[model samples]
Target chain A: MTDLLPRSGGPDPASAPGPVRRPFRDLSAEGRGRAGGRWRRGRVPGSLLSRVERRERRWSAGPAPAAPASRSLLAALLLAAATVTTLDLSTDHGPVEAARGVVADVVGPLESGTAALVRPFTAIGDFFTSRSALRAQVAELQAENDALTDQLATADVDTRRLATYDALAAEADDLDRAVVAARVVGWGAAQTFTDTVTIDAGTEDGVSADDTVIAGDGLVGRVLTADSSTSTVVLITDADSTVGARVGSSGTLGFLTGRGEVSDGATLDLELVDSTEVPDRGETVLTWGSQDGAPYLSGIRIGRVTKVYSSLRDSSVRVEVEPSVDMTSLDVVGVIVPKGTDSARGLITGSSGSSDTSGSDG
Target chain B: MSPVRTLVTGAVVLAALLLQVVVAPHVAWHGVVPDLVLLVVVAVALARGPQPAMVLGFCAGLLVDLAPPAEHVAGRWAFALVVVGYLAGRLRPDVAPTALSTVATVAGCSFVGASLVALSGLLLGDPAGVGTGELMLAVLASVVWDVALTPLVLPPLLALLRRLEPGPA
Candidate 1:
């Protein structure tokens, strides 16, 4: 029974003292036997075999090791699959929408409270900011006010004549394009692209998609999202925003794109057709519209081109037009509610700007 | 603390997340914002060991991921939070108490977490630095807020976690 068992598998001291079943079992297993250790007489001894194996391993390996292609390809494929999976899993509005609703419910009041709390801080900030520039602004305003007052005092018409003129003017029906009023409700809160704002008026409120939303002297944005109590008005100066605006006293038609409103140095891009011609600083830009044609909210004042970029090499004007909206200064402002426009719009989820998919100007 | 304390710490993390979603956007500093979730994460990591910190991070990150306008990755935050928690947990307990260290931990967690999120954006082929500056501003403000507020929050939370522990004190 003991002889029937292999020597390595069982205690078999009796069987032929068993060649120990020790080292270098096969020709394949014993490659370069003398390669690992110091050999006496050019032959490897069993005593030095393990050390020889160690040296053999060290000798075989070189530096520029190549990873297995199958594994690498599999890893790359897996990575690609994971990336796509993550994308599919990551980009969704459901959680966000629910969270928004819950957050709005919980945070709305808190925000209102915070807004209230920040009032004191705001006052302090205003004090500091106004202190530095207040003197200059006051002097400028006082000079303008004095000049205007003098002009008013010198050019007083008779009350009867003025009344007659008012009656005729009132009956004539002002033919110039006018903007309707809307209210701001929400901000886009987007990280990269911020060419949108939410206004509290929609098609039901005589507001429609594509109807321009203006704050005061310039365009705030176009109506992208129009709901009953809200409409996301993409601002004109958003990085993704663009408009066809007329510049200067010459009414030069040019494309006004947003050139990242950085710090107090907010600038609008005014790309003009004629490279030779450049808009002057403070040249007002208005939405190119009809003067007497059907009341299609046109010729609406957009902004004043502040800094014209004419490097003599760059074709585009890259004019920095300061918007009339005074983006940061606005607490509440007028949103143009163009007349005859329907406010009743079906809720379109995720589709932006109704007619124009890409909401920016060409 | 005990294992029970650890679980309670997780609940506290959830509570903190809810508070963040409900309140952080409103706490404006010069119209910039703070990240409340990051604040609580650092706080917990400071109080607990790495395992518990990782758990707190995961739950908090998931909650933030579940928050609005942020719906894409439920697990990415888990991955990020674990990393933050692991790293922060390794800090000396004494360092956790200091205002500077507290703010540093919060800022670090927020930076790491937000950077991880940007990785997702990069995968989608969006431009690099998308929302990063805003995220940084938000983290910076939150760190300031954490320094301002964590001292107020940490002791009470630690007491609460200790009390929640099932075993003897």
Candidate 2:
């Protein structure tokens, strides 16, 4: 029974006295003469023997001589990382920002190239995920197209209405303000937790920080930082972002705050200034332009009021809004450059009539 | 590390960054993308031990911090990944690794990395106002995604790095 159990001592079976019948696999193929060579050839593969030899070498080496130096190197790197974090947090826009800008500029073109390369693959993914929805949309669009074609056949009345509609659209779009068109080259938060995107256009293209970004559908976001050829746009769905909004036709003022989500079900929270005024469901929300239109432009459609909750304790209403633009599938966007100081004069004179009409039509 | 190996490491890091920036968002499950850079860093630690791994982690983290679309303070990822690399390096097994142990190591390192980032954000006051629950959720998601990705990324990466420089011979 004792012979059946292998010894807990070293690999050398010779040290143990009388006829210890060791397993063939347990014997090391070193210093055992002919029997070891026979066992090695018959049972253990060449690769296994080499692996065991390597393990033995590693065990004999104990700790590598380079261990202390590596430890010091790790400490130094950790300290450097800490220093960078402190500098970035404490200062407004310092050397770290500059370094970040440099990195952005370097990586921007590469990102855009990769995005273009991968667009078709991602589109295929989207197609499979939303195949049923796409089919429904195609049917809806086909019906709409047929109706529009029929309207076009009655040219005279339709043409006049179209002219009037185009005029209204131009005014609502703030046509006087310059906009730089750009493609969204990258997505995800990168290192930060905020929801953001990288756009191809930047300061070189007259895009700058605090500029309003918009898609064809509605407001997209605001530019947070601009490099020479690229910029970071903080989406409206980012947790820290807030846009002043005008609710319904009454022009009741409110603030739309992001909840930091970008799924199809993501929604913004609207807090009305007048808590007693309950906004009806489906009321349209539009941007109440900021001072000088730096961060957000006025009259742009934000979303519709999906749900409203009346709070008993504070007597305040919490309204939920589904954004007009799909935050998850951003593509081409425009950065609204604040018209020069000279254009400010034009805005003031044209303000009164436009501001009132900017309400629900958007 | 030899110059050729260093170059290979640099190339791998750059490729991981590009993938994270361009492809990650498209592949995000519930708005959480796996950290490819972190996975690569951890893999390197497992392959080469602590010193090279920390250096690679710091460099990779700094790049991630400075990458476009990043809005928070820089170096947060750098600090987080440095600790991740060191701990992962220390966790390296002396014997040949089984698949289960490798998966466990990747999951543990990923959890620690995600937790450190959340903790740093909490201490420094995240502007996003992420709550404890949300932070924990993010950490959990990161771990799940990374662990899921380990089979696809880690084995190929480990094999490649091992080929680049044979272990401590």
Candidate 3:
């Protein structure tokens, strides 16, 4: 009663408390006996409780623990991964590169064998598909031939002059360097996230990185990476691929970048040097080449200007150019091996669908 | 992991990598192909635990990085797949998901994986010029392909994994 009364401003309960609030273990024997055990006395079923307990146990089982050795091994592997990535990205050749070379050596034969096995089936399919395509092509060529026949009669004298220039160009191109013929073994998959192709020709056959690769139509791309018996070519339509280009009759200087894919209906982006000078549509584009014509020759046909637009970043004008070569159906191609190689002086040919490298230059 | 199980896993991974390199190109549309290697990692992680899944992921990634036609920085795929393997391993408690749910998981994980790959490439300042828009498109297409192919790939992979290590469950 006295504790319940206010002291100064409030009552002091602790002073007048009859039972102290102590822990269960600290409670006096009489207090412990008097405390209610409601949970034990509850009417909950033993079976239900057991079930719940079992479920809790099952659910509470944490993930499996890895052995210490494995953990250490994993840590070591991760560290090795970091080191390998750094070495691989920073330089060309390393232990990782040696491993890659080994993989290429081992897997290259398997890939080639698989390709050989699959070619027949694909060829059959292509044969069926090309039959209809050939009919349409024949009709188209027939109409073009008739048009050319009339034009040829009228321009016989001019044709001879153009033929002479064409011959001179081809001779000069061949005289400058020899082109190696190689077969397209495989195309880059979506998993690779690159627009590239693998060819059977490699360093053993004089194919090296940064060499110019082309098809019968025009400029295909350049060699990206090469193994002893295999080489990877980054197509001109690859998003990362860039080539110095000359646009139209005036040969306006610009550079071409790939749009990542050809089947997706993407076009090459051509950024010209002078934004003020916009090239007309239908103008031919050619490779301006580097200083020594190593990767790209001075007069390789690239594409043609289709549309023109203003540059977003600078005063230079940007235009959309359509690649002249049909990138999707590259079966056979040529690798322009520069002069001064240990291989044959003329050309080092590899697995080829046909020998189309002799005459075709730009 | 038993030696046989490890060997079988290795063989499966090598087969998937081979398919990715050889057969995937034939079916690829618009520069997007299903990530068969990632699918293997996810399936194995779901069956097995994180430790093995992550190690396998690292090895698979390294192979992809070192493989020919890979122009980007090495170990990029390894890093991305490791994250995916970890995420997939987090679902170990719910080991046996429904078929539809499994499809969803693959698609969802593929999106995360692709985005992670793109982000890593961006962080590394990819010299290959993988643009954001193009990468996004590739990711979307990849998710579609992964979802479509999950039914075919996941079940067989899960069965083989189960057969290899029956004691885990």
Candidate 4:
């Protein structure tokens, strides 16, 4: 390695025939010729002597006797790991889940603290990367705001009609649930074959498993599990996730499956139950809601269709959707928790029939 | 290991875990983040040898497996990292290694570790398993990320560990 270094003002020590040494006077030889020569008058530096001694010791020691011990340790650990994996895979609600919860509880605070410290830098990075997208969003919102203002200006002439519209809007928005707000604190490890995020909220904050999570734009995912102070949310873009979806105003029903990619314009695959019904590009998709809205709330926007493909092996059509929420840069999110079983039942009674029909078809 | 060395190792592992969970995701490229803990394991192996590396690898792997937001079965990372730690430790030289050799070992271990985890997930019937093409892409991405990060992560880590332990070369 020293040979790789540029030469200074002298010959390279590495290229010398003998060991490199400092050009010091031969004081030990002078003392040897004088007196009894039993002891040298001048000696090598103590540090240098010790370094040479250490080198000799290292050479004598050779490979340490720890090789066998380490081999045995490796074998033991591998076996232990295999046991844990088998135990975890063989049982549901096993000790592994409890241990995971404990680990999460311990690590949650540190993750959130680190996230708080690091968020600003990440925001700065995001600003630069998505500046063009942000500008486009601003323009789109401005146009929408202008259209809404025009509608408001003409509303006074139809006060009765406006009242009914307001009532209908309230009804549509009413899921009889409370939203618990949280910030994303961490994400799944790179090795884990799942797309998930950790949020700084849990059962204590009324964020429970199966509750619907959403960002300002649209649906994010559902709470997979909750510890005391943190919860894991399996993203809608996870391979294992599936959401019942309704296509545009056509009401064509289907199920959306995640493609498991999120950073680079990740899209979900929407498979319509009625193979003959074709969805047009740009049609919006929304969650049709499950019973009691446990996993997803009805009317929450998912995304707009970008492309449609007809299956070569079957009559089914596959619609690709870019999620309304950017799964890559999640920040503040809301978890929708049903107020109570009674309230949830009351809210679901009217729509239960239609939902059941859609569910059956899907 | 001495108690002080053990404590320092634990601290470093914990810090790596925090960074892996909090910072890695934000820096991900194309939906893949570098495995910081895995890199730490390799660094430990290179500096301390096989025994300590295996112990650290197992413990750190368990922490990663059980960390929040992890949806797959536990211990897959543990198993994979143990093998990586062993391989990296076995590659350690009697003399200090050159920079090029160190980087190559890191890249090789990263590839092996990522592939092991993915293959184990597939063998265990993980629902999150992707198709072969996507799996290959993810593994390659992780290797690239780990190699890119070695210069930033490994040198400082090796320095710190050598300071703490000061073992025979």
The lowest-lDDT stretch of 10 consecutive residues in candidate 4 chain A is A22-31
Q: What TM-score results for chain B in every one of the models?
A: 0.70, 0.94, 0.93, 0.94
lDDT (CA) per prediction = 0.49, 0.75, 0.69, 0.75
DockQ of each: 0.04, 0.44, 0.19, 0.47
Best by lDDT: 4
Model 3, span B96-137: residue lDDT tens: 245645676787778887887777667776546667777788
Better of 1 and 2 by DockQ: 2
Sort the predicted structures by lDDT, highest score first: 4, 2, 3, 1
Give residue B153's error in model 4 in angstroms.
1.3
**Which is the winner by TM-score between candidate 1 and candidate 3?**
3
lDDT of 1 by residue, B9-96 (tens): 6566655654443234334453333445555665556544455556566656655543332324344555566666666665523241
Model 4 residue B121 distance off true place after TM-score fit, in angstroms: 1.5
Report how far off residue A169 is in candidate 2 (Å).
5.2
Tens-place lDDT per residue, model 3, A1-362, is 13212235432323323223433111221111122211221232477754543333222212232222245545665676677678877886777777877777766656666667777776776788679978988997899699778967885455654664475466445535667788776676654456877787788878887889988888999998778877888998987888998764565788899867757346899887877778878677888877555578767788788888766677657699988887766778888875445553247433333334433222
What's the TM for model 3?
Answer: 0.74
Clashing pairs in 2: none
Itemize residue pairs with steric clashes in candidate 3.
Answer: A275-A317
User: For residues A233-280, what per-residue lDDT tens digits would candidate 2 score against the true structure?
Assistant: 999988899999987555689999998777776899998988888887
